[model samples]
Target chain A: MSKKLLLAASAAVLLNTSPALAASDADLAAIKADIQAMRAAYESKIEQLEQKVETLSAQQDQTAAKIATVEPAAGEQVATQRPATMQRNIKDSSFNPAIGVILNGKYNSFSENEGDVAGFAIGEEGERGTEGLSIDETELNFSASVDDKFRGSATIALAEHGGETEVEIEEVFIATTALPAGIEVKAGRFFSELGYLNSHHTHTDDFADRPLTNRAFLDGNYGDDGIQVSAVLPTPIYTEIGGGIFRGDDNPAGGAEGSDIGAWTAYGRVGGDIGDKTSWRVGLSTLQADDVSRDANEDEVNFSGDSDLYIADARAVYAPTGNNAEQEIIFQGEYFYRDEDGTYEDTGAATGAVDYDDGQSGWYAQSVYKFAPQWRAGARFSQLYAGDVPTGLVGSALDDEGHDPWAATAMVDWTNSEFSRLRAQYSREEVADGQEDNQFTLQYIMSLGAHGAHNY
Target chain B: MKKLSLMILTLGVLVASPSFAFAKTNIFACAPEWGALAQEIGGDKVDIYTASNANQDIHHMRAKPSLLAAMRKADLVICSGASLEIGWLPILLNKAGNNQVQEGGIGSVMASDYVPLLDVMQEKADRSMGHVHPEGNPHIHLDPNNILFLSKVIAERLSEIDASNSSAYQSNQVSFENSWTQAIAQWDNEGSHLKGQQVVVYHKSWTYLLNWLGMEAVASLEPKPGIPPNASHLKQVLQDIEGKNVKAILIAPFENEKGAKWLSEKANIPIIKLPFTVGGNAQSTDLKTMFDDTLQRLK
Candidate 1:
């Protein structure tokens, strides 16, 4: 009895020191006194409990002894006594916070026949063959809430960059449900309000290779440091409006040199059901980037005029069955235009061109069909046209007459489980200027625990 | 030409007659179990659709335009919400443009509301715990007791939505209850073979079902409750169960079984695959069949 009391007292003292308990000195002292008192009370109560346990133990022993004594005479029949049923209720709602992680790794081998034959030969010196599998994305995502209305999530990914593994913040944001207009606000580093592929993690991408438009236009893949405010509008139409202000250099490849450089983007989407089997959505987004230094040589180039980017996107998805894993056809298209005026001197002479704007537009139509529960086949056709390229030394290397790159992608993917997928794809990339590339990519994505929410 | 026009007009009138108009009650279920139950209970009176398919993980479903459309025209929407649909359900429901299925509306039914939940984070839940449901565990549908409780609630909701077929709904509920009760008894009897049997599971999703069967979940492959099994954690679990008599390693079809298979190989135990929900496995096509298959697997 005294031992139990001592154990309980020590447990209370340990609880007082725990960071999770969060007790002040005064509170700790009071709790200690209360625990002492509890121990004294339990000391007496322990006698009763000990007596009951002893009685039960004795009875159990007596039954065992009786069974032992009868077993010899009854032989094998008595030895076959059924074990007592142990009824346990496993389902209980308790506040138990669980932790989870997702580790995705892959190996890549670019075909020798792909890419420009001469360019490939030159690039081969830097290219490394497949020595072993590489960890494409290893993410640690954690989420918790202080209360019902407050929750936050942070995702960190350890990925290979520049031949070394680096840790990058994928998502670090806190969401508050207690909003005036059924709104949720998140502030952190996150993907921009851009296309579908931009918001999705690379591991969750449908195809092994990202589209040419996304790879060339969207800076360093996807994501940026920003704050986003989103809300569901209460209207007859299913509508959502969101806007964010992000640091200019959110992309890893094109980050802002100064912390003050920033950009703003706003997006609105309206969608509704056409019938039992069909649904559609129309979305429009406008992004504006402030005039800032284009590169480390900030003084070498200057913006001739304000540059604002506009993107208009719309998508329609149809499913014979409205299920996430069912066979469906998703048609999405977006138009992107960048108009900018800038002045720069490269040959000891300042040159300025008005309407030095470049309009790059691309749209893809894709269809995915589930041939079976484990297998799916999909195909997509995409085209990108870069119009009005400035022909000058000051213009970035992007200056060209124009290049219209079109691609046809075919993929076959298998879903072993909800958390695991293996996909193989063959893509033929062709440009009007006679640059053709045929690429084959195989990718495997495996998730360990609870999946994350779909990003915008 | 006049005869062809007359025939077309007659056919159009016949097809457009009000008596011949077919309007099936549209029911949208976010999970597969609800879809199965809705189909079973509504019979020919309703057309059902599930937002999550058999092959996909329901935890990370994206809200597609088609799902929103289905919700928009749906007369009733059933979901297993204890934050199970936190990722995309909100967007889908809001985009559905159907006020009836919005939050606090009669047409919206959260299956967890009727039953007790498990593994609710009493402490403030955070992202550190991979996607914890703030309300409570929404996987309660796996337990027969919860399903029994939810069936009555679903029947009552169905009656409320379609008053004209109230009696029919009630009758269907009675039949379903009777069959479910019988199935539960059979399961209990069959599961007696596994009473006190200790097993290791991959995820906490099987807690409710394991509890009902009186099975002991001695340990898990995951170090943290919801985390995926890593090599280090798998090593620890293997060491812990080295001398103990762990009859089987239980896993859900939706969970990654590679860890379980590796553990089974090292521990020399059979890997018993259990369905997380209806349609998750071939044997678990419906609620009743899910129970039967789960019990058989456990035994």
Candidate 2:
């Protein structure tokens, strides 16, 4: 404001001082005195303006300092907003873990009640449960890279058993990322890298339930605290070998009283693409547990010595569309051979424990055909190929007659989008004498968050 | 026996000779556009492989063993990061177990890191908002200006990865920049007519295009970021577009045409299925042609 007024005043002074304004000495002296007064007033005003400018600049610096100090408040703003409208500040920790939740619900109808297998000590999550609406495993998962050297993932599950809701820590693991020579070490409670289906979450499975081999051999997806170190060979073909030591907790491997490391697992896999449309992978895995104990369908079996399990899996996928994989065909199979050396006791009949050495095995094969953009049909056949137990048991559950327990299942699923899927499955089986094993299930899986991709 | 041993040794040497002589780096790109960009910068010093091709949704992908094999053999992995390859790349990296291309290594180049991104959500988005990237928009290669910055990053990395061919990569950077700058000028002049144009898009995929061409996306067919349009959103978009001077309805090739087709048939606006990236169409075989085709469609 002052500068503009000063400029106008100076202009007036200049206009009056032109050569055209010729006059006598008395007139010039009066003009000069007036000009001098005006000049003095302008000098005082300019000095005052400079002082005011400095004061304003200081005030602005104060305001900027306040803002700088309050910068941390911006972080609290992110969590304060609703999830749908929260702004993720890019500069706030350059890395964020992807969070995901998967919800699975199913309705089942069975011809007979098979929830309790008479002879075998059933594993946790052993049965498909009641014939009505039931919730399968619901998983909340988080994964991210912690640093240049490691990435981590944690999964917590809300599972239901006989109308009881239980919270379980399904997986918590940190994997080494910067290890040289194609080596990685993953440490935490995780699905053991033993078999094809043991490590995969139930949501990633094609079928609503686990296969017979996985259920029988690994006690329905074995999970425990372990450290696995895997290395991929530098050879051209894809070859990976990994070994782990786990605190035996779940079935097959009976952990020590205080979470002792009582189980060991190792696996090797070879995979490669055959052509533009076909790819295949083959893997071999083994698990050794100390002092495994469980009831095998009425035969109270306890293995005081080492129990060994061997598994082999092969999978092939053919996508007609190379990258546009709307339709595809997949063939997969798994085999398990378990040998246990222990004592057999029939607690139901109060039979004393006796020396026993037996081996059990199972196998399953499945084929899936994705016929259209949003639909797929698959069929699987699973059987307990071999079931040998200690003789003189109360129930003849593991006898040769009741052995060869097999089921054939067929399913069709329609995926409306990547986030949702509905599947219907039918299975016919007879695990024991005089039991009807016809079952039907309609299941829907809704994924609400970021889901990791399934492995081949 | 001696003769046979010598023959086998000779065969091994013959097979190993090429690797020692050239030692070209193998690059595995999650998307075809990145592969093409790598090819542009790396030239013969690198062998390029792509995980997703044209007309394939980069969001969901099957974990093919061959992709793992490619990743395993890759000396570098270039991808459109920001969780764009979240579905398949992690598993591939885990299975590949290759340290060179893991997240913090020099061999891992995320194009999103080099280019300034757009449409980064001002707020947190969840399933209710459909699928939203927390790290802003992951589609950075669509903007030609991003390519200039990314090319420099690529050249710098290629020089570091394959130091023997530093000059080749550096010269390529200069030549690529010259041609790219010229092409950008030509494209800008040609695209000047698109100024202040209003468009309808099926998704937020084309935001960079709209931002660059001075175009406004008044309405999107999708109700939310990733969700397909339902009845109300469609109806609202229809009413909102009324008297808006909308010029075109834009869509990418991979998007299903049902929604855009419905909107087009209802609104009488021409639908342009723009090839969004390299190999989007036969004419859009590379980066330059992609923009050329996109601008020509605008005209």
- Per-candidate Cα lDDT values, in order, are 0.63, 0.75
Candidate 1 local lDDT, A214-265, one digit each (tens)? 5544542446677766555544456666666667664212336566435666
- State the weakest 10-residue window (summed lDDT) of model 2 chain A: A84-93
Q: Is the docking of candidate 2 incorrect, acceptable, medium or high quality?
A: incorrect
Judge the docking of candidate 1 as incorrect, acceptable, medium or high.
incorrect
- Identify the candidate with maximal lDDT: 2
> Model 1 segments beyond 4 Å from truth?
A1-100, A111-133, A220-222, A251-261, A296-306, A321-326, A343-355, A394-396, A431-434, A452-456, B1-61, B65-78, B81-299
How many clashing residue pairs appear in each of the predictions shown? Answer: 21, 12
